[model samples]
Target: MSLSKANKSAYFAWLKHPGHYLFFKIFIWFWLTIIGTVAALVFLSNITAINAVSNEPLYGPMKKNLIYTAKSIERSAVKHKRTLSEVLVHPRLSKRKLLYLSAAQSDDSLSNKEVPESIDLSLLNFTQNMSPQIIFTEKYQAFGPVNIKVPEGSFYLYEIDINHQPPLIMRFKLMPNWMKIVIAIVASLILSFVFSRNLIAPINSLKKAAIKLSAGNLSARADISVNRKDELGILGRDFNSMANQLELLISSQKRLLADISHELRSPLTRLKMATGLAQMQANDASQSYLLRIEKEANQLDKMIADVLQVSRLEAKSQALSLQKQSLQIIVDHVINDAQFEAKQNNKQLNIVGAVDVNINCDESLIASALENLLRNAIKYANNTISITLKHADAIYIEICDDGSGVPNEQLGKLCEPFFRQSDARDRVSGGTGLGLAIAKNAITAHGGSLVLSNKEQGGLCANITLPLIKE
Candidate 1:
């Protein structure tokens, strides 16, 4: 069946307001969380790197130790009258600390034996000045290139410690900043998409179940698995429970209505038989009263039958016997009967549009519903009534009359069981008030709708729309 106007409008409204969707909100939140965490880590790393470069704990101690090693080498070379190479090989000076010295100009250095092969020596560019520089690598920290003068030529001294590894801040510094951000964004997008899908999947199932339940599918239930233990899982379980309770309650009510109507029908039948017997035995004066009693009993019987039909429709107790039939044949039968009634009542009923379409429906139910609507129009119409049929997305059967329109406030209640307007359209009009209600229920059972409205010029228009069966 096609979606109703209200369902279509709600879908469009959701499309129009994208920000109202839970998926959008959840995706954005997850994305922001991932980006924020990456940014925080980057910020902390930068701060730590800066602190290591300027703080006294790392930079100060490394500088002092480099200067002291340089001085010790120079003093040993001058006092022992030995070359700087011999002083560097001395076990007493070389084994004093886990430090290595590399010459700035010469390739000869202790780095090859003491440091990892990944350390790049070109990073340390020494000048003629006595000040030392610090260099960080993944595996080692080097404070280096101190100018050591020993009466011979000047020597460039580099102090390297193999045991001192770079911190977390320096390790990430190897990658470019833009690359880091790009990686973070890509990772966040993937993670956020997965997270939002996992979160919204169950919710979408719940929403579908709710729509089905609201659309008169009492057996509709959320397709949530028992393995889900989250809050959304709990909500789905609760929704299914509510739907079950609602279906049970409505089923019980429908059954109760049908049972009550059946019970009343027995008494009404006996009352009608008694009234007939009385009419047979009564005198002329009592004849009219007995006739009125028979008329009221007939009306009561009709009302009870209507009540039974409505309950059956509500409970879906009787399956529709559907067949592909010509719409024109059905309309012609109802119109012929209605037109004869209209002529008897001094009213004109005319068919204004073609009814050549074929539809899948229960013939008896559709014909009965149309008959009820036409009779209602005949009863209320002053001079003329019109039946107009049109086929578009669905088949539309509009029955309009030239009677005084109902009050605007009471229009919505016209199809309700036993609902009567307060003015000229009361019980005195020989109506049980269940005709429109039965018609509505019958049309609804066929996956169609009966809408009642007041014509602007003056009249009541009952429009019946039914879904066209696909070939």
Candidate 2:
């Protein structure tokens, strides 16, 4: 599609809206968020290790103590010749280290009341009967400090003489491997932000072009200056080519319609003039021949006019000489004019409820549409016809007739140029089958609608709607 600069910029603005761009930003932000989160964990681990072992690596001693406690219990068990549980009564790795073991019907119950150096006594449970083989466990308060790991169901409790002996405290911390990974992840995400921005730039341009195309500015073309000479640039080039072809095709079609309409005008005018002269010179028998000629010429004149109108509509050059007018007045007037023809066809004309309505529309154009619709209804009407006007958001003009209405299968095709419900009837009726088609075109030109449907009262109802002046 090809579009003007103003439309292009407007569409670009829509794409660049906060909500749209926010999504792209969020995609990059969240991906980076994950990376940053991982990297943060990694950095924290390194910091923790540097803080703990940079000088003396104190955790090594704490770890050694837990192992020592386990082995000590083992030796004591052998020396005392009781199972490890009975010999040591669960040695304390710290003042609060766990010192309990769940063995197979444990050789002896040896639970010390000292909490494990790394565990909270109230937060853990030990069951000797279930999975007794799981001899050890690590404990740490998530989102808190005092981190530690130790043998499961193990604690040492002894009523100590505090004044005589100094209380011992075991402090152990883990190697911060998780923190190191987090730091690496954070760094990667930061880089990803830059990458995502570069990736989406071309997409943003295409988005703008699409919006411009939708807004009736079909000339929009994308500019891809991305450093990566990949698919994005190719897409931009493709879009430009498509826009060029579309513009050319539309321009050509408009010119073709205009030229054809101009060419048809001369022949149609000549036929009308000849028919009029023939009618003026006609005698008794010649009257029927002259009448046929006049009818055919008038039909041709009407078709030529419709062709010109359609051409103007296509070129977007339809200028409306709009005036504030009463829809009811126009309806009544057209009905009066069409009534003579309805009477000549041995049909009855009936006017329904009157509606007081006003709208701004092209007077002659709207009148012509209504005139055509009423004449069509009269032609097929089986002796009875009704015209109605109603006030709503728009003024409605409805003309209905009691005749064998259009077949169910032919409704949609009725609006096509030269389409008629019954070809033989239309030929006998002396119409060129352009009445309804012309009415449709005229209504559309007035920014309104004309709809035809079978009326329940045994005929066709041509419904017209035109926007009323809001003020």
Candidate 3:
């Protein structure tokens, strides 16, 4: 089961990564090339050696002979010689039916007889030597040379109807099949593995560089590990150059936003103070109009605060003063503070859920976030608001209200700083559109998230997940 899973995973990775595919392709090609070249060389050498051996005049006119004379033309014993022609054209049934018909015939020629170990010279082509690569095995069943080799003699096994001659037998030595296959595979593996390593080393470096860059190190670069004039080396150099450009561009943008925010703070402060005083000095008739301007000035102030907070969070410049504290205690304090405002609007404030969970958090920031969320819920609720604390992987503080919930499609947009629904009815709430957004930012800074969704029946729900320390 494990091997099957591994095979499946490997196949998927190979399909997804073209580089892996290329590496295996080159490896296989290199292996095949080595095998083909070596096999061809070995085969050629064997054939050449066999030809050289066969070319030697390994036979003489009268090598050896064993013939029994029976009927002769006029009772004279035919010549007994080892020459191939003499063996076939001897007088009497010379242990070979064909030889008998071609010579002095007798019943002896029709049947073969057992004789001492010997080879039939006429059955083999002694005139031309066999190539070394030419197969010679166990007699005729297997095509390879026999184990018992006659180094100085040409031999062949032949069956003949010679009752006066022995059954012929011969043997020769040849290489084994298992040994050849082992040699081929071992040689191929060694050469291919070495070649593949050399070819794939640069690719491995590129993979490491890519991983580093993905892990937020934009300055990560690949070393020019390959010096060969190849496409891979060129690609490495180009990738390094591209990463450098990205790092520079991002740093420049961050600096620009930081500078603009810092420079705008002084003028915004002056505008906010001026608007307050202007509202105080206006006559009754203009006072209402002046108050409108004051509200707009407050909105501006709120947006500026959000911008500064966002910038601080992004720059990682906000220091957290975290401490372990009971989340129930925090919720109680915030609820106590919001109770008066809820009552003024004919709303009920309730905090009902699991309690006694302790959390490691920046107390002031978390309290501020909860306060904002509750206040927004109270403002939107039609007289009823509930703050619940549920326990799970984290402390979930959910605030649901019995008011007309947010527009279903605009749930995600409410968390954007200064983003509000476009309809006039939505803007009638008169907020700077930064309440939910700032709360989200603060929660995110504390390593939490602010989720917005509509209640099942009717209302807006804000679920804040706060990591708590186990008690």
Top candidate on TM-score is: 1
TM-score per candidate, in order?
A: 0.70, 0.54, 0.50
* CA lDDT, candidate 1, residue 439: 91
Candidate 3 residues 304-410, lDDT tens each?
Answer: 67667665655568888888888888888888889988988889987787668778888887887898889888878887898887888877888999888878878
Model 2, 294-315: lDDT tens digits are: 7767766667777677656545
RMSD of each: 6.4, 13.9, 12.6
Q: Model 3, 388: alpha-carbon shift in Å? A: 2.0
Name the lDDT of candidate 2.
Answer: 0.62
Off by over 4 Å in 2: 1-69, 76-92, 95-99, 102-258, 267-295, 314-316
Candidate 2 residue-wise lDDT at 67: 48
In model 1, the clashing pairs are: none
The lDDT values for all models are 0.79, 0.62, 0.62
Stretches of candidate 1 above 4 Å error? 1-15, 19-30, 46-120, 124-173, 190-217, 220-239, 343-350, 378-386, 400-416, 419-424, 451-461
Candidate order (TM-score)? 1, 2, 3
Off by over 4 Å in 3: 1-264, 271-293, 402-412
